[model samples]
Target chain A: MVSGIREMKRLPVGIQTAGWFDEKDPAKSFRFARECGFESVDYNIDTIIRIGRDEAGNSYSFMDKTDEDLLQYYEPFKAAAEVNNIKISQIHAHYPTYVVGDEERNAYHIKVMERILFVSRFLECPAVVIHPTKTPDRGQEREINLTMCRNMIPAALKYNVMICIENSLKRINKNVVQAIWTDVEEINWYIDTLNAEAGKEVFGFCLDTGHSHIVGRDVEMLIEDLGSRLKVLHIHDNNGTEDEHLIPYTQNPGNKGMGQIGWDGVIKALRKMNYEGALSFECARGVKLLPEGARREGMELISAIGRYFRKAIIEG
Target chain B: MKEKLLVGIGSKELLPESNLEDNLRMLKECGFESVIYSIKENDLKMQANRHVYFGAFFKAAKNAGIAISQIHFKYDEEIKECNDYIESLHNALHICNTLKCPFLVIDPIQLKDSVQEKEINLKIYRSLTPVAKKYDIKICLINTIKCAGGYHQHAIQGACADAAEAVWYIDTLNVEAGEEIFGFCLDTGCANVTARDMERFIITLGSRLKCVHISDNNGISDDHLMPYTQTLGQVDWQGFIAGLNRIGYEGALTFDVSRSIHTFPEEVRPHAMKVIAAVGKCMRKSIEAES
Candidate 1:
């Protein structure tokens, strides 16, 4: 007898750990995520670093730990992922990579990122999402981010982790406007330039659906432009005017079909590109706003939505 | 256009029943310029001293400097068979007049039989028109969705779920009344549940659209989640704002996200209200800017 059913490709669905789960307890966090129907997680390593000043005006962070100690500190997260059968698909580096005119702070951010890349390798994560710097001058913004990425090249190459540059937004005059890497051409240029500098494909793009929507960038077109260079995703929704980081499809005002993001077009574009990355949710606000007891239900709903997207992408 | 589109919230979840004055003050502090006074059946049935009860509520709202944008009249299933339901509606209209609210949003009577559904709702709305007109209030029919098996089940089209049918209901009622008395309250969450394209619905309704119950949801259920806070792409907020802009909507941007608000801890509810008001302000700005 011959079986008639063909096997289907199952895409890994993931969620971020910053606001949804207790990151201090990696064992519980990974287990809870797996229980909530997630197969992967975008480890929010940014929480480990403290960038602001203390009461004494002294900056401090977990980045003060030695390389070996930091790796040991995160060893349990790796073990927990293995035990729960969850993949650490990606790690998010601390942001604001270049604070304006603050050389010491900017240097500290670079040092933190380098250490994070090292820890990401220990966690067996494949990608690290690093945000581009924002400045009033477009040229200065490019120079700052390019230099930052260039500085991370050695660590990225050594650890074999792809540095994923995410599209960002900036508030100008109380209005959100497109910032560094929001445009397809601008992002492509950054990825291409960084990869060229590294002598390999060490750079990739992490498309943030919420950020793109806030700045009125067409998600489908952005995905199509990034194509194979897109290695990760920060899937979330917004009302097109604010970076709310909401769950998909929840932003329609007055049920008037005024949703800023076109999710169907987004899924279709991802399908067309044959994107092979986890559908990771970066909707921390969605989970954070819910009461503690209701968070698991919220995560389950988000995971179910991911399954819907996965089926649509694979079958369509 | 900018002045007309003010941000507001429903009082059902955001305000504590015991401390109406303090809560209204909090709402004012949270940047809400208007509020939809959610009237329950009991509130309407308070009978002899109804004015005494609602007068204080109105006083608190006035003191807080918040406009009573509208009144949400909660409906019971047995409304068609009960004479008390009609009386309750009259009472609500009276309260609306007392509160100086311009619009009163009510759900259409949904009978199992479609013909009866239309007949009963028309009679009910027609009966309320005398009092509505006396109070100088517009009776607004909200578009609703029916969940076939129960909650969380697939939502199908309910009364006035279609734009043409909604328009027909309003126009027929107004024509019969010999004046414009009935308008529409578009519940965006209900539209999402029934998969109605809001832009088309709003455009079709045009000037008849008077009020809105702005909320978000996954298409499967009427979750009443905050706008821009649900599963991605389930609600089309862009099209919603565009439709409002196209129609030059001048009503307050009132939010009815009670379920979403209830999901927050009691202590966190105030902060959640702030976020809701902020989202409303952002939406109001978008609509006004386009206009």
Candidate 2:
């Protein structure tokens, strides 16, 4: 309770498991995250997209796990997180959840979302990051995303967790262009509408720094616009060209004297908006590419930066 | 001429109990010498956990003295992300390498537009060719056939509907890849569903036939029934047997007929399997007599 100077809230720094590329066990990765001084972790659920499919050709995932099975499956992770004193920030749901041209398949994807909600509750997590539905009808993107939200919100409420709709960027497939909720305004619309309709904060936003950087949307503006509705963060840097989730301040290859993102600006904007969540790093790709034993140094550097930013900008 | 008939079965037949050792034992008991192995949903999770390795699975098969003639891999993801799709295929290919499986079969993805079908199929196979080469496995593309109004039609709308078109597809991939890793998996049930001339189709496959899914249909649907079922519309068994003998086809006469066998009660399945084994024995004797 120091009085004169404004003290920075000791917001926990977190890391997602996907960045621990080769590390197969979540318990081991969570231990490492704790040792590296990260206080929380964004657990990744789709590290290895195994090739086995159901009869209808849907890839099996945690969604396929029954309640008893899933509980047994992730119990070790829960124990590790508890023992390491690391908070479970959220679960990162598998991407490209939107199925095209098939009602049965779409229903399957929704079922997966419901299972994820149950998992979120099982893990005692407060939120789950869900990608917006990607479809061909750009004009109807908002409606489609809303429809998906409506479909999952009851389950979200039932599980007492929040579904954070992450903003996306344009991606092409088979010569057809699909625009997910790439625009900030549309995302704002989704959050506002969902929260308002639910009469509570049922839906929130997960600002993906890499996706925002790729689509060239202003990170600072997004914070200002989102205000308190932003519940989670996927903080990572990338070369301006691709969604390579590199560690913050890493040099972008072939781009002399320029890094992918301005971490200082992002922190400053967070301070302005007074974000309360953990400063989670989604830079596992950068971490994985390091020479075997050198990865710890990389994680240490990341944790140090997280502390530095917290003290310099957030503390002031 | 091929040495023995090498009657084969699909691993799917032993599902629900899905114990690899037990399945292999059952297949052997049923007189099956070859099998079309699939990485099912549960098996995939087991592989991820390191609890069930393909090496061990195949070793049990080897101990049972059964050969994995081909692997049926149907990827669950839509081909939206090319690299992701390629990566999934690479994992499956690695498993094939572990099992030393010689052939991998896939149902060619169907797109709405016919003109784009060839290009898409070529692009997908082209991406998979390097992995196929690395694993020393042949990629076999199966044809698309539909049954409508009691008549079978080779998919006039999808890629590689006709036998010649299938050969052309495989050849195009082979030339572009600079290797003979690409080939055709002639699904007899698909042929029957389309009412195709089995002899002509087999001749067209010629030396390019890397694997075969020898099942029967009633010309009304791809029922995956046992050969000589007679209940299904007639499969030209004589013409098909003669065509393989004529081409000197060395591949196994593998049956992807679990769908029909699975219809019977668990107790009756072994008996149904005996019937299939008898038919396979008959076919092999006939082929060997010709040789």
Candidate 3:
């Protein structure tokens, strides 16, 4: 076994095979990741909240959700991280509708993020990420967005968790249409405007690889412009049109993974920027679990990319 | 190992005094090829490595030769962090894959508090389907009613507060999406109130009938006792098991007598497993005779 390029030493590089981080697999997905030798992962907050509840007791979800009146379920995550030797580098919180919209829930959201921050700090994670929604059509959606965000900034300030907003990728979902304003130009404008208005670096964008692909944004180009300002990346591959979040360096049916945008170049750009966070496994491919010594192809793919990062990018 | 049917006794079954491996060995000896394993809401983190608590159970299962067929994630975790849960699912799926178990059962997370945030729920179903498909493990949602306590009396409300609507909604979404990834675990006790149809629900669920959690309750409430205990709700136990037969449900029928076995704490769990194993034989004979 040619030991992974020695220079690849602790690049803080991670992959998103949920198995290594989680117990989520067909018994096969884990085998693929482990056999391949990648040991980091990211997960959905919902799984943490609903995994073991009776019916009426599950009032807690990861997203700062509606009517935030319930108990918190953060221990599962703390325990899961410890088991896998995986650290939660970023929270990847869902839309904080309750926090941004309601003041009380806003306080709760901050407290929750702060709590996650305590864990993230232990994990040495740098950020807590989320997706953005268009404001409800009250008087001013922008105001609601800003007002809700205004409360959110303090939470980020208190916790060491940098709050980042991600673009929604449900191009076909009519329901999300109202809360959608993720055109790249509109996003850059949103970032600049929000910061200028707040006069603080309170929030940033999470580059959702699939969403950007859906919008036909060149991954490399987005990296170049958004690099320094951006706070996170929801990394995964997809067929060009639909957001079928697939593993990276591989192409989906209709579109080459990353579409016309070159995967190699995108990685090169991200490497150039020295993005030290997670290349979160936001998609699914074939996965498995096994009795033992299981093989994980996804981990192999991630390891391959890690090698590329170490060899051509880091060395170069 | 043939994919045997089983149901979780609830992860809260993990008592401090419980000998994880001892009970697991008993589970294997009793011929339980499947299990609906769970973790407490607070213990969801520790449940992952499984080795922590079940290191013995896992090793024993391997040694005595049994398969962990199903998973009942009975704890509460964040849905938005589904990305992380997917990771956990990967591990759960790993167990299923390890045993070649066919199905994995879970509770549908209601992140959005109301019947209103249907879209978020839909997003969740859609999001996890890919992983479900990738793992080749059948993922199902279990409906349940919490036995609430008060100064006046007691009751069992459907799992997740109005799960019937949500399960119907999300299942429709997944089915419409042509994704067979979402299904129901169909707890005998939980179905008392939340199940859409006692007979038709199981029959229609057909192959989607992954696992059936067998428990009983008084007509007044869900007691989760052994069969012949409850006469409540709309479920026909004999017919429901028949429904499992009708739907061709080949998964485990986990006998969750957790409350009953709580004191013994893994001691009599296998004895209970033996009783359930007998029940499994009846089920197999009944189904095979019918077919």
Q: Pick the DockQ winner.
A: 1
Chain B TM-score per candidate, please.
Answer: 0.95, 0.89, 0.74
Encode model 3's per-residue lDDT on A1-316: one tens digit a residue.
0111122224444555343444343234334344454444444442343322236543344433332221223344445555555545456554444434455545555455555545444444566666554544645756666655565665555544556667775433542221344555656766677666656665667777777766766778778777656555666654454455544433312222323235666677877877655555564431221111212323444455555554555655
**Candidate 3 local Cα displacement, residue A82, angstroms:** 6.5
Instruction: Tell me the TM-score of each prediction against the true structure.
Output: 0.56, 0.48, 0.41
The best candidate by TM-score is 1
- Candidate 2's displacement at residue B133, Å, is 58
Each model's lDDT comes to 0.81, 0.71, 0.53
- Sort by lDDT, top down from the best: 1, 2, 3
For candidate 3, what is the DockQ-based docking class? incorrect
lDDT of 2 by residue, A30-60 (tens): 7778888788778786554332468877656
| Residues A36-75, model 1: lDDT tens digits | 8898888887876767767875656887799888878888
For model 2, how does the per-residue alpha-carbon lDDT over B237-264 read when each residue is reduced to its tens digit?
Answer: 8888788888877787788888767544
- Candidate 1's C-alpha runs over 4 A off are A1-10, A52-59, A253-260, B1-291
